[model samples]
Target: MPSSLPSTLLFLSAGIFLAITGTLDAITFLAVIGCAVCSLLTITERTELAYIGGLALISISLILQAVLESKCITCLKADTLILAAVICLTPFQNFKLPAQIMSAVMSVVMFFAVVTVVPVESESTDIKPHGFGQYLEVQETSGEKLTLNTAENPVLLFSPSCSACEKALNKVMEQDADGTKWKLVLSSSKEKDIKKANELLKRIGYTGTLYTYDWHGSVPIVIYTDENDSTIVSHSVDKTIPLL
Candidate 1:
């Protein structure tokens, strides 16, 4: 077997993983194709070109994460794997000065393109003095409405297509949350998203009340309101789950 075969397989695997877990956005889809092309280049002994492609892929991944504030663990894992593939191909790289300069230029262009083209969601700036009550009210007017239990102090904001949300929900299922009345809020109201959310909840055996909201912020958000009237909002699964 060729020594480059492992690197080729690694590149292919990272691409497939991203395709499966990532949203079908233009950037993500193009990245997947880039990975496939890189793998093919590696197999064909064009390691220099493959290495340049790997660098561009890494740049795109990091740029998206920074711009989107995405908390998708699956996307992160795929990026890490792509990095590994790039490292594996490093020893085989032999770029001339002109080629190196061109690669750098290309990366810069891709960076600007992603930043300009991707639509960013604007977050709500209003403070919810009534905590979950405000969320319920907004949902009633714009999205799905649900009755919140007065006793339930924790609310989880998530999106069906979010990898971090799925991980957070899985964590909740694995632990002891028996007495807690948890409220699940979906950030999107699209039919496909709702269908996927319901399927996820059913698979996890979650019996909590699920609501939909027109949320603009990054998700897998956990809101905990203490008895002292203090509201704590957590964005990551690790920070959010411990508070539950």
Candidate 2:
């Protein structure tokens, strides 16, 4: 076989491999390997050197892609691969300019997509009743006060932050069983949150007790008591509570 024939075969194989797999995964990373291997083979004088460089490029690209997806590297592996690939081509004067440009663009877009899909963190808003023993004193809202000293009806423990609490509140209001008095407690950790929950309750015409700024440790819990303040029912404001 002629010297030019081997180089031609190398370029053809690399191109075919890239065409099949490049778009199947990310076009950017795979294309870089394909172009690098093809370029090294077509330009380098020695037959052994061309074959060795192509094999090395494939290995490095595969390893880099693995680390990128796994996030095992310090910086994202995709970014590192792009940087390394550009550096490798810089040493060679005859590189495919268009192929390198496309790979760079694709890598950036993939990174942006990954960032958009990641979940964000939020702070907890459960209000736990603390120091209640001090404020056990009965206070009246809207010139109406229910005695918390006796238990004549079932209590519904609720929190504004809890989806279950909202559903439960709706049920008690719309589907009252024999119009029995159901004590409502809006459990919230912050006074502002409790106040907001109370406003919502009021908008829904809920005449329940609005307990604000009460927390036990880090957890927030709300207690619902009968008109006489006995037979308390408690519910914790947590993520696991299901909506009705």
Candidate 3:
């Protein structure tokens, strides 16, 4: 019975580490719990430690989930509950198979309880919008140097053919038809695509300025800058088009 101290400490430390660092693998710990359940360890006083381990594992799973922010985190929570039940009820050394089964059930419950409390882009404006403004590379119909040396609230909107980019562009164009404050830059790598991008200007009726550069795989990049603070918001997925 006293020997269960080390195991409890180990499990507790693991749970706490998981909660803080959000890096421990809950599945591995669950597997450990499973092995203990199927073994003669469940019939010993040390079985209680396994239940504690289950609780700790769940705590770790939830803490890491909040920090890491992944869609797969729910799976971790579910699996931990199942293993915790085994630990809670299997500590009865004399109750035979029924006790072990009960342990399994309680282990699952402990798993659920630990997590029940912790309910806590992509074209991402995630990217700092920079270097997309190549206004010097632009040329008008009269071969005049199209420069944005004096435009107010100059917003450089870059996009390819991504649906998110398309949606963002449509929103920008719909709101700002004259394209005075918004600069839509079609990003493309292929030569044929550049020619197609030229039509985008005509489609938008943006007589103000048009700029193009070799697309380096970053679609829907928006850069908003002023004399005071420069803000770059770029993303490959759905994001707010801030070129207005």
Candidate 4:
């Protein structure tokens, strides 16, 4: 058995773990590649490759936590473990102890960083209260407060950060007609969130009214009132298309 086999296996396992738990984003792709390279270096017993690969893995992990603002506990744990393993496996003259200690410190810093940087409200389970025909008032981007017209039916509740919302909005725009009245409500009122929402609307050339509402629920929600005045809330874009 190769002396470096355990480290190689650890790196490969960490890479697979990250790929499974993470979204298909650029940062995640880089991290996965870093892990694979680290594993390959370990198997070849190249000290220089180990040093470079280990440094890359450390940087990638920190980027995932601090720069990209990933809050996945599993991801953080995997990163910490991978860092520690890399530090241990790297060939450093009389520096293994210090490297391991540094890895531990980094793990602590990263754990605190993830907890403190992400807001508590992001994890709140509170959902929107009103459903169908309820009289709800939302704030427009122009700073005007307006009530949603239940008679209009089919109000779209979306968030700027949601991919599903973006896809649904695209479909809504494609199917838009001359007399169609499309009402869109931004589900989050955070300044950055509102900015993102507006950017998306502008990019897609949406001219409809966008109101801001403080709601916590699965997005791309389609709310409408039936002939009997009952409110219907749907999460499917196809269900929303006919009404649009």
User: Best by TM-score, which number?
Assistant: 1
Model 1 poorest 10 in a row by lDDT: 133-142
Ranking by lDDT: 4, 1, 3, 2
Model 4, 162-210: lDDT tens digits are: 5557777888878772215667888766677688677878877887777
**Tens-digit lDDT track for model 1 on 210-239?**
677656555677766556655656564454
Arranged by TM-score, best first: 1, 4, 3, 2
C-alpha lDDT of residue 199 in model 2: 67
Of the candidates numbered 1 and 2, which has the greater lDDT value? 1
Once fitted onto the true fold, the runs of candidate 2 whose alpha carbons sit more than 4 angstroms away are 1-147, 176-180, 188-190, 207-244
Quantify all predictions' global Cα lDDT against the true fold: 0.65, 0.41, 0.46, 0.66
Which parts of model 4 have CA positions greater than 4 angstroms off?
1-132, 177-180
**Candidate 3 lDDT score at position 141:** 33
Best by lDDT: 4
> How many clashing residue pairs, candidate 2?
11
The 10 consecutive residues of candidate 2 with the worst lDDT sum are 69-78
Q: Estimate each model's TM-score.
A: 0.57, 0.29, 0.37, 0.52
